[model samples]
Target chain A: MRVELDVPKCVASGQCVMAAPDVFDQRDDDGVAILLEERPGEELLDDVREAVAVCPAAAIRLVEG
Target chain B: MSDALACPVTGASGPLPEYPLPRAAECPLAPAPAAQELRSEKPITRVRIWNGSTPWLVTRHADQRALLPDPRVSDDDLDPGFPYVNAHRAAIAPVSPRLITNTDAPEHTRLRRTVNGPFVVKRIEKMREPVQKIVDDLIDEMLAGPNPVDLLTAFALPVPSLVIAQLLGVPYEDHDFFQRSSSLVLDGSVPADEARRVSGELAAYLDNLIIQKTADPDDDVLSEMAGRVQAGEMTHTEAVHMGVAMLIAGHETTATMISLGTLALLQHPDQLALLRETDDPKVVANAVDEVLRYLSIVQTGVRRVAKDDIEIGDVVIRKGDGIIFDLHAANWDPEVFPGAQRLDIARPARIHQAFGYGPHQCLGQNLARLELQVVYGTLYRRVPTLRLAAAIEDLEFDHTGTTYGVHGLPVAW
Candidate 1:
């Protein structure tokens, strides 16, 4: 599985970081999401999915194969 | 349809249950009974609001999630169909400056960007140590000062005021002034003139503070906004208003959560025990979200005007129609949260809409959550004997304010 973040659409609510800190982080300057792991391990999948689900701007996408 | 279901004002087919329906006295913690019923029976239905305008009240969690982010939905308060929370909001809409709260993208996206940097989860996490200090000091003061104190004034109210003041670089010495003025501004029952007066005072105060920060900037949110104003990224007034917005937005709502959240814990001894006994930060954090889900404190539903015709489920919301997304209703929706009425701290409840959803969701939510986590984690453990000094029935609840909270939480530890 892979993760994507549309930084333009990110509202900086930080729901993604709260859901999956290992998979996501926010920029210190403007809080736009930063994808830490483009392709996370299986153990982190559920948390990544939650990050995708809860991002207020709907900026995070989990591309599944 | 039966004549009984016909709305008198709109001649609509179903009864337009009034918007901002009163909560049942017996279940002070829950959303209005009628609103929950509407979630199940008529997820998207019209309801009359303060100005006699009939706006569609979207009650279901699924429906709110689907509709709030749609481009057809608008945050513009200037639209004729926009459902103002009350008369004061209606009166002030025309003169209000464009801010992150009232604009849509790309304007909202721009305005929000100028301020979002400091509030991100990482930025807020840095404050946990300081926030813990604030909580500890306040608890110490409470312990030293009096027994059975009014927790609302003693601890709950000061926590956010002090924190926000330090963050905004506003002098905590003026907290009493800002707190009082901000309270008047949020009170729905306050007359339009009085609300305007207090809001103006707050704006002017911040405007002056911004000018000072511009000269000798401090390490704070207001300073960052002031830098933006200098860089031509935003207007001077915009920076000032943003400060007021942060104070008004972050202050009372967080204070309410502290007070009402404590009240909720005291009411549910089992849940209180879990919170008190837990040494895990994750447990404390999850408990904070669960309590947020349980309370869903913001009573005035997120309001918007439909910019274009949009079809969802069976109803078609026409262009120029108004919509209200009842966060409490959606948070309590049984489809998403089974046994929605129960206040269980162990639930996986981060999905709640208490901070709302979409781009206009609460900007200070991460910070608010951090404050809550600190207080919920520390207070119970520090004062294991904490109990309500007053009967739940005897407590007064503020129904007219933007956020629902108790007037005074008398607590004895």
Candidate 2:
């Protein structure tokens, strides 16, 4: 699974960080989401999916295989 | 039932249940029973609002999740079809400057970006210790003061007021004035003229504060916004309006949660015990979400106007039609949350739309959660004997406001 964050579309509500802190973080200045890891381990898949589901701006996408 | 009755005012034939159906007096914590029934009977059906307009009320959790982020659904209250919560909102819409609350993307995206930095989880998380101190001190003050005090005035109201004041760099000394003004602005029961007058006062207050913060920069959200105004990213008026918006948005809602959440916990001793006994921050955090889901306090369903026709399931929402997402109903949707009515603190309830859903979701959510987590985590633990001083039936609930909450919550430890 690969996680993609459209930085410009991010509203910075921080659900991604709350859902999958290991995979996403927010920049201190604008609070736009920054991907911590593009391809996290299989263990983090569920959390990543939750992040995609809850991202208010629909900024996060999951590339699943 | 036959479609015999006509709306006396509009002469629209049919019995459309009102958008905000009345909650059962006995079960004050639950969503309106009629609203819950609509989720199963007619997930997307029209309901009459204040202005005699029948807007489609979307009740199901799944439907709200799908529709809120759709481009066709607009937050632009300026649209003719936009369902204003009341006359005041309708009157204010024409003159109001575009802000994060009232604009669609590209515009909303640009405005929201300038202010989101301070509210991001990482930045807000840094305030946990200070917030904890605020909660602790408030509890201490409550302990020292009169017994069986109105918790609304004592603790619940001040926590967010002080925190928001500190965050916005507004003087805490001026909180009494702003708190009263902000509540008046949010109170739907207030006469439109009065609400508008108060709203103007708050805007003026913030406008002056922004001028001060601009000249003498401080480490705060308003200061950051002031800096943006200097950079020409946002206008002076937009910065001021945003300040008023944050204060009005953050103050009463958090206060309501604190006071009302306590009432809920007191009602369920077993759940209250879980919170009181828990040393785990995760447990407390989950408890806050559960209570938030249970209360679903924002009574004015999120209002939007359809920019284009939207089809879902068998129904077609025409372009220029209005839509209202009943958060209480959606939060209690059985498909998303099985045993939906039950307030199980242990339930996986983070998906709840208590802060709402979509790009315009609450910007102060991270901060709100932290404040709640701190309060829910600390208050119960510090005052283990804490219980309601007033009977449940006697307590007055403010149904007319944008958020539904108690007028006064008397408690004693």
Candidate 3:
């Protein structure tokens, strides 16, 4: 599985960070979600899905590699 | 004989109790006994509220998570069937500007985007040091003055009031005026007309501030909003009303949390000790969410109406019908929380609905959380011997306001 974060669409609810912190971290200035890893390993798939599910702004998307 | 089939009738035994049921005197920290019971029995049932309107009162955690985000569900208060918290809210609904609080979907998305920059997790997290400084200074002043200090006035109230003022570029010296006006507007016991007048004053004050920010823009949220007005991104009226909303929503809720949360901690010395002794931000953060869940200070619940017929579980909310999410009950739900009655700071409680859920969750929640974390981390540790001056039973709880809290908490160390 491949994951991509739409940083511009992010509202900084931080649900993604809470769900998959290793793959996403918020910028300090505006709190927009920024990608920490473009392609996290398979071990992080469940959490990435959870992060996508919980983002209030629907800012995260997954792409199957 | 199933309650689902029961006629939509008004009666005590009609599956749903009257809305805003009285909290049991013996159970100060739990949801209203009726709400707690209903959470187990009929998670979603119609209940009568003030002004003789009936709305579906959702009590379970999972149900709230499911329906709050449904497209059919809405936050627009202008709907005739929308469950207003009180007559005052109903009175203001029509005249209330189209705001992030009142609009749904595309409009809320737009307004929320304009103001979302300041409240995101990372932005609010930067406030820790300054918020801690404010808490430390307030503690210093409180200690220097009186033994039995009113924590509501001294510490709990000032922290958010000051922080918000700083954020919005309001002079902290005039905190008395805006603070009092905001409180009056939220106080349900106050007459609707009086509340309206106070609300008007708050809006007018913010209007002038927005104008000031327009010409003399500063490094603050209000200034950013003023810039939006200049860019034609939002109307001037909308900006002022948004400021009023932030002040009103941010003020008492955090104040109540501090006083009531401290009150809860004092009742359980072990929990209070755990909070005080720990230097871990994670522990303090969890404690804040636990207290927010355990108390669920926004006692009236998140009010909404259905735009179209929506079905979930065993019920369907018809088009134009009302829905009230019983936040306190959902937070205390036994299914989501084992031993829900016990106050455990160690619980992984980040999922609680104290901030509500979905798109309209809370605009100021991250800011509230940071202010709370700083106070909770600083207060008990600073004044290690702090204790309540009066017994819990003797304190007067303010049930007349939007947030359930004590009128004043007198504490001594």
Candidate 4:
């Protein structure tokens, strides 16, 4: 699974990064959301979707492989 | 006309107009001349205004603070002839039982205690790292862009919305709806019919979410409230009202403060540069307080009705009369803050009515402080090159609304 983020929409509320830090990271400067992993192993799919589901701005998405 | 009625701003006053007075464009802070006039005399004074009848205006720093949590000051608008309630009736309908602002004493204390644990100083301190991460991520995007980003929409609105949404356990996808509904509710331009329609829809949405949480609880605030409601600690209706109130108050006020604070920083380049150079958290915390005090975006406080005959300063407020504590005026009073008009981050012993005083002081103040400390600290350090896209004078402040804010802060690095 690939994690995608609409950077503009990401408010950096840190929900995504909190839920799945391995897949999502916050930029140190402005608190925008950034995806750390383009594609993750099948085992992490649940975590990625959880991150998307938890995003307050709906800025995160999971692109399933 | 007595010389005592001199205006606070111009130091010229006679018998001033009444409560719920029409908006004065030049001085939006105090609606009545007596309010401004009272400010000049003492740290706090009272003004009697006759909107249709008579109402008392609390104009001093200490007095406003004293009255906020006073039992004699009721928050109930159900009273038949209260001026402020009747005046704004077209604007706000009592959708839910009055939340924290309107309630008093034991009930207010009880309701406030339920979620107080989450917002305590220590718990909020624990959120610093997470809040910092959020701030850093947002700044990263602003830098990624070319130039001239609309900070209000891109930065200010989303930051608080995301933070509060996470706290409430609401999904991010739902924020767009939350933001829209909240804006509509706050926006005075939205006609009564449309505002009510939007509010009803939003309430329905929240009701559904409450039902979902009731069935399958999680480790979120909403879930916690659901459990409390089920256990008879809180009513189902209280849970629903609280959920909506938390969502709106938690986000809107902070968002406006952030945006307005940014505008202040940009206008004062020296202060902006000072923030850029400082890495100390103490300095940043002080800066946050100063910004909150200076901007006071919550503007006028939630209205409180006089439960009994109460004397505030020199004014005797009769029973059933409504009073609006002018937060902006109190925060800006020169008595408490020597250089109250200036935004000095280093001002010592700074106490302002920004978060309010007494028992009803903002429950979310700790959360707001943490979010601000992170945002201001990170923004300056990362974007030292940041500057406004437009001149400060050219920017429009949201003067007409109950909440004061800049419509949009166009900026670039």
Candidate 5:
């Protein structure tokens, strides 16, 4: 599945990273989300979903293949 | 014939004047007086409000969490023309852009979207190294000094303050300005005029920073915001307001938690010992939640307003009525947290109200958690022999303000 983030909506709170580290990582300086891959492995679905749910700004979304 | 006597709700009762209503000054967390009483009764009784009516105090965990995000209630304090003036005048004055704390959905969602990128967990994890380095440097400075040091001034305050400053692309040299302004703004007793002056100065400084970032784009979030402004995605004023909010909220809450969390852990030696031995991140994570619940540094969630007449429990709240979710009282409620008062680092399945609930929950929670996890992990490991320098009774807790914290925490290793 592909994950798309509305970067403008993200606040860099790190909920996505804490929930799904493999798929999402932050930039070194300002701590903004830097997705590692557009489509992550199937096994990481639970975590990615949690990220979507917990994001205070509701910035993350899943694009199922 | 003797007339039947009835208890009048508005007038005095018998010879002993009716139970005097509880003024903000009489409230334990009041700023005017240091000797306010803490009403910790069972079943969560209603307290007579100074505003001439009584609002039910939902002291139990289940009740508060259940009602916090209820559609019937609201978070807007301005609908009734700011009733909290008697309570929070000094804390929020010379208001900038409407803050996340005061806004609800739609509007809140829109405002939060402007700068949500910096706080995502993935982004924050990338900050682990830098944050750890910041913590390490602060600790090094603390150890460089004498044995007994004020952890509040040295380690706890600086780490978060510097991290937040860096995140906003504000120079670390301006840490004093940010720290002082935040302190004054958060202090409920500060005069409104002084608070406004400080806020104006901070806003002007932030405005300058935003302009510089606009002129010369860089990798920092501020530069990104500047870029967005140029592209019409956001305005320069919006960026300034958000930046100021993030800087103030980011550092103030985390700094208070670190100091108070440490004090909590130190007081409970068994919990501290257990935390020291645990290497598992999950275990450490659970411990962080417990500390948040136990200390509840942010005493109450921001006020919410009732959009329409609503009934919470047995009480009927009229439209536009203001409600505050008492996080501290909720966290300590026995119905939700069995043995709620005890500080158990290993407490499992603990859901805390420290970050509020539903859509308006704290946007910076994850970053706050990451800071706490790193700070607590390194703190106990590096300063294994750490202990309080002053007696527990002597410690002065600043519960009078919105952010509850000890005035100073002196420690020795």
Candidate 6:
């Protein structure tokens, strides 16, 4: 699973960081989501999916490539 | 009073109950008992409101999630059928410019897009250090002065005004004027003409600021908006109104959360102790969301007008009908949240609709969250012995406003 985040569009509500901490960490300065592991194994998919669902700005997108 | 206020139930008593039902004076924190009763008896029940309109009052979480985002929902307040919060809102709807608050999708999408850049997580997060400084400085001043002070005035109100002033490149000193005007506009108890006068003053204030920014652009939201006006991307009036919306929206709600959230924490000592002990930003952040959910401060609920016929559960809402989603009922819903009434800080409260839901969800929410995270994470720890100076009953609560909050929260260490 390839996870992509549109940094510019991200409103940084921190849902992604809260939902999938290992997969997402907010940049300390701007608090925009920084993908920790863009391609994650199956174990983290549930959280990754939840992050995308909760992001207020619709900034996170998961690509199944 | 005709049969309009009568409950449709086959054998019931009293009026159908007012839409903005009075919260029990004793149970200041809980939603109106009538609202809670309606949530259980009929999740989608009709309730008469200020202007004698009977909008469907939705009370369940699942019901709100199903209905708020439905394409059939319309937020255009100008529509004669819109469920306005009060006469003041209804009176202005016809003259009010198209705004993020009143416009529905497509147009809402377009309008929201123009100003969405400034509030995105990245931009708001950048302000964290600055907001931290603001909170810390305020705490120092509060500590140095009187033992018992109204947190509402000293800490809660100013933090947002300063932050928003910084964001807008407006002077923080002028907050008193805008704050008064915004309060008058949002206060349902105020007469319509008075609210209109205040609204005009606010517009004129923003208009003058927009003009200033046009000549000497700064690294701020208003300056960015002025640039848009110059590029013909947005009109002068649109820019001015957006400035007013962001200022008013950001100020009162965040102020309310800080003051009232602290009050809630103080009431729940165990929860307060837990939050105070936790140094983890994650824990603190989650606790903020939980407080927002528990309070569900936007008491009037997210108002909308059904643009097309829609069916959810057993109820069918006809086109042009007004809908009011009672956020408190939905947030405390038992089906999604077990032991919902209990203020469990550890609960996963992120998806709560305190910010409302769907596209029109609060545009300034990210900023509000960060400000709260800083204040909540800091205040309790800084003043370990902090306690409310007055009994909960003694505190004056603003029941007639858009958000349910305390007029003042007197506290001492």
Candidate 6 clashing pairs?
A11-B120, A11-B121, A12-B121, B5-B16
Question: Taking the tens digit of each residue's C-alpha lDDT, what string does model 4 give over B1-413?
Answer: 11112223543344544443333444332333444455666433333443455455566776775676466767666564344533455246455365556566566555555655456444456778867776777778777875888887777877876676667677768977876776776556689999889988877877777779989887567777778888888787787777777767777678887887887777667777878789898788789988887776654445666878887556677888767676666766777777665677888423566766545667677688889988998877787777789976567777545567777888887
Candidate 3 versus the native: TM-score?
0.88
Docking band of candidate 3: acceptable
| Number of residue pairs clashing in candidate 6, backbone atoms closer than 3 angstroms, sequence gap of 3 or more or interchain | 4
Per-residue lDDT over A10-53 for candidate 3, one digit per residue giving the tens place of the 0 to 100 score:
55677787678888887654466788878888898787887886
Report residue B103 deviation for candidate 1 (angstroms): 1.3
Q: Model 5, range B135-208, lDDT digits (tens) per residue?
A: 99889888899879888878777777778777778777787787677667655568999988988888899889
DockQ for candidate 3, please give it.
0.39
Assess the local accuracy of residue B393 in candidate 1 as a C-alpha lDDT between 0 and 100.
88
Lowest lDDT block of 10, candidate 1 chain B: B1-10
- Cα-based lDDT at residue B92, candidate 5: 59
Per-residue accuracy of model 5 over A1-65 as CA lDDT, tens digit each: 88999775555556677778888987543455778878888899888987776554557899867
In lDDT terms, how accurate is model 3? 0.81
Each prediction's DockQ? 0.83, 0.84, 0.39, 0.01, 0.24, 0.21
**TM-score of each predicted structure versus truth:** 0.92, 0.92, 0.88, 0.74, 0.76, 0.85
lDDT of 3 at B410: 94
lDDT at position B410, candidate 4: 89
Q: In model 5, how large is the Cα lDDT of residue A42?
A: 85
Worst 10 residues of 1 chain A by lDDT: A56-65
Every candidate's fraction of true contacts kept comes to 0.80, 0.88, 0.29, 0.00, 0.39, 0.12
lDDT of 3 at B102: 85
Candidate 1 lDDT, B1-413, residue by residue in tens? 11111211111224878778877676778788788778888889999987888999998998999888787899999999999999989899999888787899888987787788889787788888988888899899999998989998888878887788778877768867866777678656689999999889888888998888899998888888889899998889778777777877898899899999998888788889988998999999899999898889989999999999999999999999999999998997878888777788898888899999999999999889999999999998999999899988899999887889988899897
What's the distance in Å from true for residue B143, model 4? Answer: 2.4
Residue range B110-204, candidate 6, lDDT tens digits: 66667776875667778999899989998999999998999887888878877887788776688678656766776567898998998899889
- Runs off by more than 4 Å, candidate 3: A4-12, A18-22, A25-38, A41-65, B1-14, B171-205
Better-scoring candidate (DockQ), 4 or 6:
6
